[model samples]
Target: MENSFLNRIKGKEFIFSTLLVAFVTVIGSFFRGIIDASNFAVLFLLAVVLSALWWGMASSVFTAFFGVLAFDFFLVPPYNSFSVSDLKYIYTFVGFIITGVIVSMVASRARRQAIETKQREARTAVLYRFSNEMAECETTPQVIGAVRKNVGELLGCSTAVFMPHKDGISDAGSDADFPLDTHEYAVAQWAFSNKKPAGSGTTTLSAAKAFYVPLETSLEAVGVLGIRTADGRVIFNTSEMELVTALANQSSVAIQRAVLTEKSREMELAKKTQALQAALLNSISHDLRTPLVSITGALSALSQDFEAVDAADRKELLQTAYDDSLHLNEIVGNILDMTRVESGNLKLNVRPCDLRDLIGASLTQLKDKLEGRMVAVDIPGDLLEVPVDFSLMMRVFINLIDNAAKYSPAGSEIYIGAKTEGNMAVMTVKDSGFGIPSGDLEHIFDKFFRAVKPRQVSGTGLGLSICRGIVEAHGGKIWARNNTESGAVFFIRLPLGDAGHGGRD
Candidate 1:
């Protein structure tokens, strides 16, 4: 009842407490035959204690002062008269009031301490929870998400997190929809750059809607955290400020960890790319030089020994030069096609195209190469039509079939077949040669990944890679695997039913 009364009192609950003390004294006086009037000081002391606990020193002072008047008028010296015969009663009355004041002071001090301690404990709990969440985060986005969630729960406000990027500060968690106008962003940027707090309550650009704190670590500031309302005003208490600063410190470490991890990955990738580029350059140089040297030798034989050489020898030299030139042209064409695929410039013209036509065209182009090899075709009649780029798809099949023929022995059987599986048209090419290494299966489609091991192959290593690129561009997948008995099998799967709109993008 006292606690509820205190809540409803606002500022004047102490009056009722003092009045109760007076009323209790009067009741004690009514029972003066059984109780001593001097004992009513205990009632005055109770009122003072109640006032101090609920209303602090202000109400306690009023209760102490008024309590003495009630005691002196009703219970002191000459009983119901405003006259004192004994002057010593003044000293006694003064002592009683002083005692009440002392008790009031002590109780008020304890009450204030209790309130402050409870508030501090609440803030500490919030801080601990926020830190725990940030510690559990394994990535930058997770850290940002933790901050938004924890801060909103603690302060009951909207939150935003911005990380420094090459373009500028951008939303990290993507839930930061607070009032961050140009001025606010500038303030946040300043806070991030200076590794300090700004906006709302700070000395720097106080007009900003959000309060920004830099997520700083020992190394540097990696990001900025901000809290604000839609209308751009939130006043934080001292404890809140401390909690946010601690959270910022914890968040900085998490973000730093994420950033360093990403940087390490990028550096590793760059190193791999550098190594790949160097290998590609060396292989391309050797291939180009070998063909040029062969063509030059044949031309020299034709020009210098024209009168001495026979017609048959001259014809052989001419054919050799012409074949090398064609090989060079094919290498250049594969490189160009790979560039187009990598740059996303290969636009496809999608329509109902016959797959058999593509297989026929590719076989016609490589008829001389597959002169002695047995070619088997097993395409289902129902799988005749598919959406594809006619020329690009022809290149895809040509590369796979030619790749199979080049690797296998003379007169080796090459199987080419297609069938419908689910909503996709699946094609396969099997070569009866030595199967690929298990370790190299995954890298078979990478550029410059040559399959020949002990023997020297006569073509660039980009043919398979280019084939993969073209098939992927047409919204298909191409993969190679070792066959069960011997050689390797390549599968190409393309979605049917107007799938991918013929790779328009």
Candidate 2:
């Protein structure tokens, strides 16, 4: 847009300069009889100065040369010929041309400075907008995308950015967009390695098809930016090359910022993972020791006093040993199941199964825990069978029921319900216990995350996390929320149609 406007103005200047010279010649002719030839030469000089000031170098020089010709033919003593009547007129013509040339040079220099100033302002505005856009970019891909968009628009060329990784530079899968053969890639790598521009416009590797510029900052080079014009023409004039260099510098900073952000996130994740491992170790050691101690004590007592202990007391001790061993077994099983889920090694045996049977098995297993609680089941009799891995889904119910029994107070009611809605089977387990804290609701299913407020209960906090993993693996989802009245409700929603159809590994 700016270029077209300047071109139109230049064209008008050409026409106006020609007309002004011609108008001066007509006035000189009308007064030739009265005015001296020297006076007419002065008038032509005035026209030359005005042309130089107003219409710039080309127009001023054109008017100077043409006006001198008209003066000799119309106002000089020899009115119709290039031949000078006197030797003095030759000096005047030569003087006129030299003065006009000098003035035109000065005027053109000033015009060049003005045009460059305007272009600099334009480049600054473009760079400022690009910097702002890049500042908002938080990821490496986003920064690259912004680079492609801005560079493509600014230069009207195809652009590609290659970032360094541990293995090597990543092309970002831009082959179809900006294809580079072995030689072109070598040129790009050289630019990056040497921290210099290469390829078409640069002195280095000038024969290459695309211009390769290193995206460099004060610290280091982050990547290489490649630009290829469609016609394979060299288009990087002095000002444009400067603009591109400024853009590359800005992009380098943004890319470095994004890379640092990604590294920071990885560091944070590693810190969190270390913390989780420590928690797992502590929970496993405590859980494993408690049951082992109980079993050992019970067995030692029974073994030492088999004859001396009374029959009823003997039976009680034996039962304690058995129950503690079962508890120990459950702890080990939970750890193994969690490992399977985490490692993506848990394979499903998909089959059609009734929800009632699964709930029955879960309740029977938890009968000892729910001894005093009033349990209610509300599964509809006509509910259809669900496709799932029977064993994994059964474990889901057992964990939910057992978790409810642990959290809820004895004698409080626990409700288990299931129903189908729009091809999805929704099951819920509600417990009349102290509800989950609002702040902890979201993190409840995170591995090893126990409720902060309720500290009375103790177990490895892996059951709900395992449940979520299993449910999701079976094309389902699970979530928990507190009821308005009292306690908390856990909901599991599974797709009834073709869930676990492929038997996931």
Best by lDDT: 2
Report how far off residue 160 is in candidate 1 (Å): 3.0
In model 1, which regions exceed 4 Å deviation?
1-146, 163-176, 193-195, 230-233, 452-456, 497-505
Tens digit of lDDT per residue, candidate 1, span 318-408?
9999999988898888878878877788888877677777898999999999998899998765436788889988889999998898788
Winner by TM-score: 2
List, residue by residue over 223-244, the lDDT tens digit for candidate 2: 9999987667665777778889
Whole-model lDDT per candidate: 0.80, 0.85
